[model samples]
Target chain A: MTDPPDRRPGGRTARVRAQVLDAVRAELAEGGHEGLTVEGVATRAGVHRTTVYRRWRDVGGLLADLISAAGEIDWQPPDTGSLRGDLTALNEEILESLTVRPSFAVALMAASFHSEQAARAQTRLWEDRYAQCEVVVARAAGRGELPPGDTDARGLLIAATAPLYHASVLMRADPDPRLPARAAAAAVLAAAAGAFSAGGGTA
Target chain B: MTDPPDRRPGGRTARVRAQVLDAVRAELAEGGHEGLTVEGVATRAGVHRTTVYRRWRDVGGLLADLISAAGEIDWQPPDTGSLRGDLTALNEEILESLTVRPSFAVALMAASFHSEQAARAQTRLWEDRYAQCEVVVARAAGRGELPPGDTDARGLLIAATAPLYHASVLMRADPDPRLPARAAAAAVLAAAAGAFSAGGGTA
Candidate 1:
């Protein structure tokens, strides 16, 4: 089947999608999920309501598309020659993203809680983000810095992020400047002790 | 000022408070935060709206009281003599609570995201829960199961719960049957290595 020109990468269709998604973010920031509307996003994005409805159908659909689009962004894992450095850098990046737009982060999480589709999107988002960490672990193993066997990268990554999320999201505590380093240190310490390896404690 | 008989613990006032809070949970489970109504809750509790309003004032007020009431319930730490056993018991408790009423858990979390009052309540809830874990750590340290001197009970408790929360809450993944054991093992392994002591990696 021949591809439509507007549907190609970086085409008009893609631009419209990006514009609409950006508008959705703005709406969420201004009024939260409850106040967001298809009409509002359409107007903010300078797109027709019909188009928004045709593409997204509703707020849940828009959220799913927004999450998927966010996952599509290019993300590269840090390679600082050591497992500790790379993990620290990764955590710092997460800390920055979360702290930079905490309300947005909270809104996204809140949306995921109420809607099944949004929850699925969040799962996909986490899976994709975890893939980046896997690469970092793979590189560390290649450099002989990590154990040369099957490793549970998921446990290490979750351990690194969970404390930060607990403090930031659940507790609503002010961001601790040392949290990134502490998280990375803990994860590295645990991983070094084989806690995150296959059949290990964290496994 | 002396306390009135009705205002004392296990009295009529306390009974009313418990009834109202229980109704609130039922409302949240059935309709979520958006659909929860003060009138509905009052009716469900077989109390007048005036009584609910006099006590709670509004839904936010009800949520705050509900969260506090939940915290006030007797929650003793499992004194299993071993840090590993205690942590496993704690995680098991969390697993049972979350799994038994998944919708209620999600509703509570979602409410915290939108309302500052709810967020504060959630923070208080965590603080209260962590206190129970702190006692477990203190007892373990006394028994020489954990390191001497000051320990970071918060880190160990958070580490034990974070992965489970990440999987069950954020990713909406089904609760892993082995998660309680794995979480305890990881925390115990790390804590044994001083990762949860003063000046440890997680500190």
Candidate 2:
């Protein structure tokens, strides 16, 4: 530990970890990326710098934990047996991820610029998210909810949410429930079906 | 304005301006929005501080000029008989914008954080681009390329390009011509048609 091991017999380790994360988030909010430092985090958390370093190999690791802990929506697309229902549920989940923790959101995005670890973490987060969509998509395809030969459906599904969520996160825009996702969903399915019918099923 | 206010000055003025813009873009490429500043840009351009400030009132103005001047797409959507041709044209333009001027791309995105001026500028740019699509849309509508009451077709046309464009810019990803635009165009139109035709052109 930089100061000394904060083996405070009065408190549990989990609580201390939470405190450290809270400090990191607060620092990020106050100073953008420039504010966060291991020593500063230690001082705020009342933990040793060595303790923080020990727990996380570096700054990125510590930030990664914070982001991972921030809150991810469970992969649960509604099975209303329609494409509309599936898309609505998916969009709601994306909105939740974007809205739940604003500071963590900004920090992760900014950190993604400077840290390979953050970029990888961000990429994995997206992969996990897109995988969730694929389940509902496959089900929709089987049920004929999606048009045949509409293999491009999933890409549109994500294109729907990515921009709206990105606008909220990066631009700090007032969340518009209907812009990117709803529009993409409405349009994507339309074009896919038209193209599919035009091509004939076998084509 | 930097070297001199000589509007009819020799090619030297043009070269100096190019050098400065190159420096700004380089800075943005290396470090995102946070690295852009008069001091940093001046250092990179090998120009005096007064020059940058004199030509452009602030970073926002300089950034705006860069966006309007260099980022202008070569062509807008033309009066094509099919919606597909117009949308393809528009999306291709967006992809071209993203690939070439990545620095200004990030700047356009980051500027949204600082002021409504940026938002207005961004919105105007989108609207201007959308106007280009509007012509093809109106032609298509008159020709029965779409149903009678297609409310979100404009939104759909944009969905093919905007979200994907926003993502590639923010995530620093290579712009893929085929998947994001072509797939999205196909899918979005399908979804839009489904939503509308199922509703008897009410959607």
Candidate 3:
């Protein structure tokens, strides 16, 4: 079967998709979710409005595609020698993404709250990222850094990283230089104590 | 001096404000941020559009006032005998708020991302809640549950509660019933190890 014109990679379809998604990010960063509109994005992308309407449908579709595009980036979890180091490196990367000016990450997050399509796409991206990071726990266990038995990598990772989001996104607090390491250290201590051991009721 | 009519408690101004803010929450819960509009809120509140316009000016203004009203609520941190218990209680409350159907808390949080005024109001509310929760850490220190030093109550609290928000909000994961106590236990263990001590760089 022949591939559709829009489905061909490195073709005009791919170019339009890239242009539209870039415009979506630009609009979100500059004006936030409130100002993002199909017409505005189409104008910014130098694409026809009817083309955007037909392909993307609305702002929700644009947001969903933007999040899906993020998933396509070649990203990997930090692989420092120790779990503590790895988690800290991971956190630093997160901090950088969240704190960058006109942060595309933050804009995407805000967009997710406003769009069901975006929210579902974000959830898939998060699940994929967490699955990828499980190797960090596996490596730590192999090195005997964690207690014997299965550790809840999901729980551990959440504990290690949630503070950054809480402080920056929810509380809107000024970024503290030491927080990434401190939070990672705390999670490490807790994990070593088996707080995140699977099926364990509590520490 | 006599209070201005609008400034008097229990007067028409206060009633209108209450009605309008309640309407805002209802609209946000039902329609998310996209469905929120000054006209919708005013109509839902049974107030004249001019009255809402004169007072709230826009959807952002309505959202800000709604968040400010949340701060007016008389609330206290749980005083369970142990720090772990107290934190668990706090986490449970947080979980309930986040997981409730048509959750006003979640809606308000989503609204904050779209409006600068609402964001500032949410930041203030978070600061106040954190300040109130400091007593939990203080009580723990008094009982020798925490290390002998200035504990970073804010940091500890963030760690304990962040997992719930991360799982439920960001990941869109199903609520884990044991998470509140499990997370509290992890934070307690970390705190006892001096991970949260203000001057301690890392555990």
Candidate 4:
């Protein structure tokens, strides 16, 4: 039988990988993804160049890993007993994640734009996030809080959050404190009116 | 009097500038905005390098002018009688513009992200676009087609289009042909429900 690679939680390899990722975050925080380099990350992590190259391959590889790691965080989905409450909770979480760590968020966005691999990772992350949102909607439907039809959960979620993304990401505007709640309310009202139903909304 | 910079329609200066901008659009269409160069624009436009440099200053300057020139086009705002029709018309225009000349659209978007000067131009463009949308809502309200008390036209418009931008721009996904109509209906329903009214929603 072939030998297994290190799978221990606190092994040397895990520690090294953690250090490298931390360095990558630091570099992204210092600037944007404009001029990030593997050598720079390696130097910042205090790891050898060859080690960094052999492991990460390039900046795109590092960014893809970073995105995948972000998906791996043990983030709990919102379950606040109502669609409005659940949606508000989800939007607040997104707002906090995007604003509290601006550099990381911007870097992740830039990588998604600049690299195909990172874009795939971003799509996967979005799919996972949408799945969580679906649970909230499905539960609401079960409770008769929703209209008696198949509401497009993913569409509602995107509609709820897209304005926030436009303001912060494209227009470079400051995040409005009331935006998350407003966005959630808008989506909820529309959904309750059957605007998100497959046969109703897309006029 | 100091010599007047050629302000005459179809004057030598105007023609040269048009040629340069045409070349810029062609180049952007061919290769995107990643490595667009002034010299390349000059050569393609059959203009001298010094003339291009003196007039446009740099790529950012060229892009700024390009954006301003775009604003100068004879693009009419949506004039449909109903808010839903008007918003759908607006979104159709946006979708068509973004998809029809992808290189030009991507370059403009990239310029908005890459340069502060271009960002200002982009903001102005948005303001202009929003003002046009405001007219559609104002007219609807005037005709008693809308429920009253400050409908937040800009907010509604952002809600209507942000999903389309998310689908086409950030996510790198195929353009969803049904998105524009869906977005318009969602915004109209939300607006009618008073979700976009400052005092009505965000509860």
The 0-to-1 C-alpha lDDT of every candidate, in the order given, reads 0.80, 0.62, 0.87, 0.80
Writing each residue's lDDT as its tens digit, candidate 4 over A1-203 gives: 33367677967678788989998888888877766899999999988888889988998888988888888888777999988888888888777777786457666876666677877888888777677668788898999988897889888888888887777777667778888888888888888887898787765
Of 1 and 2, which scores higher on TM-score?
Answer: 1
> Per-prediction DockQ scores?
0.60, 0.36, 0.71, 0.66
Candidate 4: clashing pairs of residues: none
In terms of TM-score, the best-performing candidate is: 3
Q: In candidate 2, what are the lDDT values of residues A1-203, reduced to their tens digit?
A: 33345577644676777889888887877776556788988898888888899987677887777766653545465676756666666666666656665556655766765667766677666656566667766776788765666455445555556556555654455667755346445644553454333342122
* Fnat for the candidates in order: 0.63, 0.35, 0.78, 0.63
lDDT per residue as tens, model 3, B1-203: 34446656779778888888888878877887678888898899998899899988888888888888888899999998999999999999999999999877788788788788989998999888989999999999999998887999888989889988888877878989899999999998888777898776374
Worst 10 residues of 1 chain B by lDDT: B1-10
Q: Between 2 and 3, whose lDDT is larger?
A: 3
Query: What lDDT score goes with residue A68 in model 2?
Result: 67
Model 2 vs. true fold: TM: 0.74
**DockQ pick, better of 1 and 3:** 3
Q: Please give me the total number of clashing residue pairs in predicted model 4.
A: 0
Q: Whole-model lDDT for model 3 versus the true structure? A: 0.87
Instruction: Provide all candidates' interface root-mean-square deviations.
Output: 1.8, 5.1, 1.3, 1.3
Candidate 1's error at A95, in angstroms? Answer: 1.3
